[model samples]
Target: MPLKTVNVGLIQQACGADRNTNLAESINGIRELAEHGAELIVLPELHAHSYFCQLEDPTSFNLAEPIPGPTTDALGAIARELGVVIVASVFERRAAGLYHNTAVVLERDGHIAGTYRKMHIPDHPGYYEKYHFTPGDLGFTPIDTSVGRLGVLASWDQWFPEAARLMALAGADLLLYPTAIGWNPDDEEEERQRQWEAWIIAQRAHAIANGIPVVVCNRVGSEDDPSGQTPGISFWGTSFIVGPQGEWLGTASAEEPATLVAEVDLSRSEEVRQAWPYLRDRRIDAYAGLLKRYLDR
Candidate 1:
């Protein structure tokens, strides 16, 4: 195959309580990258509003909107005008009393390419997602676009190797993660460092294991816990793009908002996979143990 290079952009920024301001910032970031010749752009998870999952309030459900609702309409227009494919995350109100953390992909022509509902929902202190999102029913499927096939996943999904492998098996050219992760304000500095390093290492491992490039866009800055029980979360923004061999292509700032554009040679995945041959060596016939909750003797 011929070398197919694509300019991919990552938008990492902080979100405030104001919806319009957040949306505008994301749009501006997209436009900036588009002007710099990026054909594919990705934004941080839930760029339309603050990380409301910090504390689960029933009123937070109000933030959820339909797939073709206002957010898509707005992003679609920019995609059309800029002629860029966009991967954006949304708080999806699938139905009355049913919602999901979803990722929406817009083609360069401003049409809804495809959508992925988040399969993994994290439930823990400082990241109470189960209270707001229903686990995705839409399995691991990649969205096809002009640039290439995109394997889109949300925040928590990045931690699971199964998710990445499934997408790769389905023929994804590149893996994209729109994330909103941060540190609990009370943790020690060493603990925070370990957490951040683990996050980076895990994602890089996915690229090495699957022989596909990986892109991650994460939110930056601090968001206070609405209930005031805890100091709140300090979002560590280290958005990055890595090649098929798990080599860093480009990385953004850890403490500030950043816009990054990196040229990815899509054909490299084929070359790397041919050399690594990890997929060819899979023991699919003996992996029934993966389906069980635990293997009790």
Candidate 2:
């Protein structure tokens, strides 16, 4: 079980073309939040560089680096200096030709707690991640840390309840999503609104189902697509934290760089589960067909 209370900070920032500049900005944001008494800091996915998934080119592969590479080294030092736990997303260069979207947890002492590679890779209109990253083989398991047990998931992973449920079953105390999703410039007002609503509701539903708090940190601002075939995506940066009962704790703006800090009562999860025991009533025996692609005859 977690302590009496855990304070989580979400860093929502705009990604620039320069990776060095972006890393410095994220470091500054983490420091600012730590000064404000944030014990656990979460950063947006791929914070070191601009969203390169908008286009598929061989040059994008250069963005991937090793797990204990320079980025983690710098972040580990920051974590140690501030005595805070940090969850940072990165594009991992596992080998000469293989890469993955990975999240690393750094303990207060600057040692790496664990790592979770993104399982669900999206290949949508603007999210061409499949070309750059291979699906994670690290199964759905929580990373035990100094702060608490963290079930860290990537952007597209938030859309699937199975991923969240598996983490909960594995004893995850809280779910953290390092995300980078945005609105297409050509999307109509109504379409954009619905998409945003679904995005927020889906994660909150995960919190409600698993009886745990959820934290999401998303990138803000728009970056142009190099191909020039279409207008770039305007990242809707409404980073937020939701409670076990699907209640909103704190939320950032949809178009600005901001740091949101909120306190969550980890013990309340037990209370909520006792009152509404969804997990206890699950029919584990009747779910063998879930492995099939479809039930069509």
Candidate 3:
């Protein structure tokens, strides 16, 4: 079969308190990438505002909005104008007290393609997402678009191999992560480096295991904590694109705002999977243990 290539772009941006400014920066990045022939563009997680999950105040919930609300309206307009598929993350306000970390996909014609709420919610010192977002109800499913089937997941979801595997089994062509992960400012340099390396390795391992390309977009720069109890988080922005063979196609800077476009050959996954054949030899019957929390004797 012939090569099925899609030019993918990732925007690595630093958000501030001003939502307008942050959204404008994302829009500029999208326009720039579209001009350079990017058919599909992805933004970082919660790109519209600062990382406000640092505190568990009820006021922070005001930042959440409906899915077809303002942010998507603006991004959809751009996607329609440029005729490119755009994957964006949003803090979805489902109801009065229900919220979710949702990843929204816009088709080329400016329509809502699909959405994937982040299933895994992390609660740590600097990153306190569980306090803000409810667990995602949508199962591991891929959003269909003109380019291909995109398995879009949020920051915490990237760490789970089961999530990636389920998406691959459901006919996903590429696994995309809209991430907002970073290091604690108080941690030692060595520890920080280990964390960063582990993050990258885990995602790349998912690619190698599933025989699908992995695209991740992360934020850059530091955002202060509201309570001032801790130093704050310094988002290490090493956004990257890797092939089905876990080979780096392109990578952005570790501490700067960047726009990267890489041509992903969708057809290559078939060849890689055929040679590796990891999926073919799987023992599905014995995998019931995975469903349980743990194998306690």
Point out the higher-scoring one by TM-score: 2 or 3. 3
Q: Kindly list the per-residue Cα lDDT of model 1 for residues 17-37, writing each as its tens digit.
A: 999999999999999999899
Looking at model 3, how many pairs of residues clash? 0
Worst 10 residues of 1 by lDDT: 47-56
Q: What lDDT tens digits, residue by residue, belong to model 2 across residues 1-297?
A: 755689999999999989899999999999999998899999999999999999889999988899899899999999999999999998999999999999999999998999999999999777899999999999998999877899999999999999999999999999999999989989999999999999999999999999999999999999888889779899999999999999999999999999999998889999999999999999999998888879888
TM per candidate: 0.99, 0.98, 0.99
RMSD, every candidate, angstroms: 0.6, 1.1, 0.6
Ranking by lDDT: 3, 1, 2
Off by over 4 Å in 2: 1-3
Please list the residue runs of candidate 3 whose C-alpha ends up more than 4 Å from where it truly belongs after superposition.
none
Best by lDDT: 3
Q: CA lDDT of each candidate?
A: 0.95, 0.94, 0.96
TM-score preference between candidates 1 and 2, better one: 1
